[model samples]
Target: MDHYAFTLVNGVFEDKVRTDPNNRKPPTLIRQPQLGLKSYFDGTSNPCDKNIPQPWDRLRDYVDVLNRESNEGAKYKVIFVLRHGYSLHNYIEKGVKKVNEAGEEVKNDWRKGLKFAYQKEVSLEALRGAGCEIPRVLEDHLREGDPNAAARVSLYDAALLPKEIALQIRGSEVTNNDAEGLGEQWLRWVAEDEFPLPGAIYTSPLRRCLETTKKVYGPVFAANPKKHKFQPIIMENLREKGNGDACNYRSTTKYILDKYPNYMPEPDFTESDEYEYQIQRAENGEPTESDEELEERMRKVLKDIFDDDKTSVVSLTTHSFSIGALTKVLGNARILDEGDITAFLVKAVPL
Candidate 1:
């Protein structure tokens, strides 16, 4: 599979070939983004999952300063856990891996994700809105493209960046869509059922998470200017676990600030902390933290935040490793969708 890139060209989004990963040359035709989030990532183990951990169990993981309050001082604080929207890397990952209906790893049907991805979930509105033209040679991969495979018209933003753009092209496997139902489900809970508006958001310092934050909640915050736009704090701990190229790569601070001016970056934020993350992954070629280490970190981050934060509701956006790790500590695992947002109602007992 070719490593194609999507970039903004004079306010329009364009797709072109990017054969190498480490190439630092400036893009010739478009304003190539320095962020890895802008590029499609390569292969991985398995790629499709959309379920989440049970809310109550996750809530129970919250702790009190001491159990001295007769168990009444311990409980959960309301929170939302979400995954990043689909990415070019995700397109690459899902384009190759294969899983069963239950979303379990089946085999190396690597070619499956490729076909499905090329045949990205189709809708006329999305296609017509795609601002750029699809070359005839590339049209063979698309069902909607003309016979000559020459969708040779100018591809536009609306089409290139579809509202459903967050979702990966799944063809018949709309189960990902079913799993992604949390977006609407969360809205229904908030609007009709009267759920609390998010007080703040803490997300992985990845481009996709930031993008997802805007797409999923931007409209709500836009309507209510008083909340200061619920600026998401870029929490480093929330990034996906790994020392590999995919996990460690990040857009520069200038890049991120330019792309998302509204987001509140941590005072100490940096672009790529590859050295630090490599330290986290291992030392002297030996594995660093086992399950216990990850659990400890997960516990510490969640507990410290709950104790310090007075807000009624918060949200965390990051990758599956972090999500699944927390799920295992709390209970079992449910593969959450790329853009899914699931809520948990937690009440902290007074210390």
Candidate 2:
């Protein structure tokens, strides 16, 4: 069987590892963590707590064990590490309200127009003006003792409050349009007629990542209806930093920046209690593992995947820090700087 793996890392694929089965014991396949555990975003100060080892850490452990087990002349290999694609929320951010030089709050054009139209059409003055233009119609519409006129007036008044508020609220435009466009280009390149290999796909559970996967795989699946069915495995651990807190809108980089501007250069991952605990352990020469330890962990994970002789191909979909950390650990510090679609190929024999 042809083994191929493609991982989405830091908005692109950084490496691809493959191996052909040979005259050796088949390597064990390492199972990735469940999607639910990977995606959980508890907002404790240190998100990487004792109860929650970082995803990278878990991946590393798996790799280390695999390497140790395959010391008996087994071949190990790995392929493509990648980052998830742009998200819907990224687009939404572009449309948030911003103050112009005049200090006037100007919302997105669409929101502004919607607000203005709602206000103008529902104003008491508007109805009065309409009455003057259609006196006979108003008289005919409102019977001598009917309450329709008063009801209409009350409805207009009620709408006025919300309409005024909505005018102040800003609207958003698409933010990651460029990123998505680039992603599409990369997908096309990989699926060319002469493309080298068959590949598997994986991704983080975030909307942006899924959207990217869909865009990239849609055409492939269309062209090869039976051959290229994109099976995306959503790994929660691959999500962006602060995913959990950001989802609640209570504690996020944006929320913190808006609320506590003075805390610039936000504290390291150790700013959280869980991280602090790990730091304390490290200080004592007994480091506790946490998400902050993703880089080191990913190395082992990759190594383990490589050592698995049975699996020749695989792919991962992760995020920026995780991708950078993993690539750095894999002796390719410069890979972090490579643009989207960066790919690496590695071949190793049992040591």
Candidate 3:
């Protein structure tokens, strides 16, 4: 399937905020000049320039027209893709310290508390049996008589830190049209009508993505109970590209379903990590999932959505790498920052 991306604030449309050399930042709703200026499909025929009272209404009508006129084999879908809020893994990866809610520095750095990570449910005993070298941090924890210290250090399928949860709360406010002074709010731009509600919602089964999706859409679901009868569908393919990183490795289906009992899992969803990490590289090469594999997984997921869903508007909550691969599969290029939201007008061409 091919796609065309437009009207993007953080994705393709670059601006001073995103390009500032002194303090480069992601395109956030709180940032000024949100959503960019009203753009036109053609240079002359701006939809908002028409007699339409609301810019969003004009844009919606334009999209409706495009879908209404397109051939049956080629249908346009407005995919609202959002990268999940920063996870603990992200915090560790950046190796930056920030004051947390407790006013204490959140972990000195990734190396401070983290020596290495183990796949979900993999115990220190198992790793030791596999001849994995125990990190000093883990050894210190174990020496302290803490049995669960390895689990804490591993942080398998990382969860969002408190700051990221706060970020999601702010992001949700914008989604619910609660931004009063945060500059141009895209959801508010369609104040004449409720911004097009996502007909279907999908999310990575990873804990952080699921948590972020819930946090961001909690109000939306509450406001439009009829539109969102169920929680977002958990999709394995929406998971981040695997490089043998514990954070990229998702939890088991049982674990996820236990947390999100109402969320739908695809029929083929496996109870355990379908793609487990290969500890012995000699036999299986590197455990990392290649970019080509990631793109193919993305393509398969897109095809599944297009085939099963009739909704024109769909929403996805996933990781940065997953979103990047998805865009690549759709013939666009975007590497969304953590917690950033962007949309793409994708046309699924039956191949």
Which candidate wins on lDDT? 3
Model 3 C-alpha lDDT per residue in residues 187-235, reported as the tens digit of each score: 3433334456677889998898887777666655665576556468888
Candidate 2 vs candidate 3: which has greater TM-score?
A: 3
lDDT (tens digit, per residue) of candidate 1 on 21-109: 33422221111222111122111122112131422222222212222232544534445677775554454344323223223232123
The number of the candidate with the highest TM-score is: 3
Better of 1 and 2 by lDDT: 1
Q: What TM-score, computed on C-alpha atoms, does each candidate reach?
A: 0.56, 0.39, 0.68
Candidate 2: where are CA atoms >4 Å away? 1-78, 88-187, 190-193, 241-244, 247-292, 307-311, 334-339, 348-351
Candidate closer to the true structure by lDDT (higher is better), 2 or 3: 3
- Report how far off residue 33 is in candidate 2 (Å): 34
C-alpha lDDT (0 to 100) for residue 332 of candidate 1: 37
Give the per-residue lDDT of model 2 (tens digit) for 65-155: 4445644443323354554443322222222322122122333343333332223123334443322121332333333346355423221
Sorted by TM-score (best first), the order is 3, 1, 2
